[model samples]
Target: MGWLHSLFSPLKKLWFRMHSTTQNKGRGIYILYEDVKSCPYEDVHVLWSILVESNSASLPSKK
Candidate 1:
């Protein structure tokens, strides 16, 4: 029911946050590329580009 979802959603999120593994608690990003050997070069390039751009934007510039 909708009411049940509303009641439990926050609790579920809290539970996961409290119980998450060490690997899931960091600021690191994890990308899963299944069948990496067969993945297209363009796909990898695009992902790399987005990550680079986002990281650069988030970093503070030095004067």
Candidate 2:
């Protein structure tokens, strides 16, 4: 494997570990490697929605 991939592989595993636990159950979305980096034009909107939703969920709610 290339050095760059070797570097990212561990990070990806760590991300999955953090998000796939019971604490985050039902709140995680998994995308295949190919689909994420080279997503088709038709699927761009889907990716955008996921990003927006993740960001919104991370923000604190106003009183």
Candidate 3:
């Protein structure tokens, strides 16, 4: 496991930084759901990104 993880240290850092929403802060760890209310506990991003949404708006204007 150590060897495997060593291979992804860069990716790990990027994932944590990007997805955590705030670098070096614990806001990434169940903080919203555990500390706040009025926010949906179900809607959360587990990682930095997911499947790309089709760029429907990027299509060139119709003729």
Candidate 4:
């Protein structure tokens, strides 16, 4: 499974970085906003994926 782990390693790192960066500081909302504003284009897809995943997971499912 080494290849599988390697395949996901970058995504895992991105998630950890985003999570830790936001959580470690006070005023997370403002910090996240600033980070997004300054974030590089290459990282935007990863950020968007994280947002979509979290948002969908948090919402209640329709019956």
Q: Write the per-residue lDDT of candidate 4 for residues 1-63, one digit (tens) a residue.
A: 999999999999999999988767757656776777777786885886698699799999999
Candidate 2 — which residues are off by over 4 angstroms?
Answer: 1-40
Instruction: Give the Å shift of residue 20 in candidate 2.
Output: 37
lDDT by candidate, in order shown: 0.71, 0.74, 0.54, 0.82
Off by over 4 Å in 4: 27-63
- Give the alpha carbon lDDT tens digit for every residue of 1-63 in model 1: 999999999999988877786556442444343434346788886787787699899999999
> Between candidates 1 and 4, which one is better according to lDDT?
4
Among all candidates shown, the one with the greatest lDDT: 4
Relative to the unseen true structure, what is the Cα RMSD of model 1?
7.8
Q: Report the Cα lDDT for residue 38, model 3.
A: 44
**In model 2, which range of ten residues has the least summed lDDT?**
25-34
Top candidate on TM-score is: 4
Clash totals in order? 0, 0, 0, 0
How does each model score on TM-score? Answer: 0.36, 0.35, 0.27, 0.38
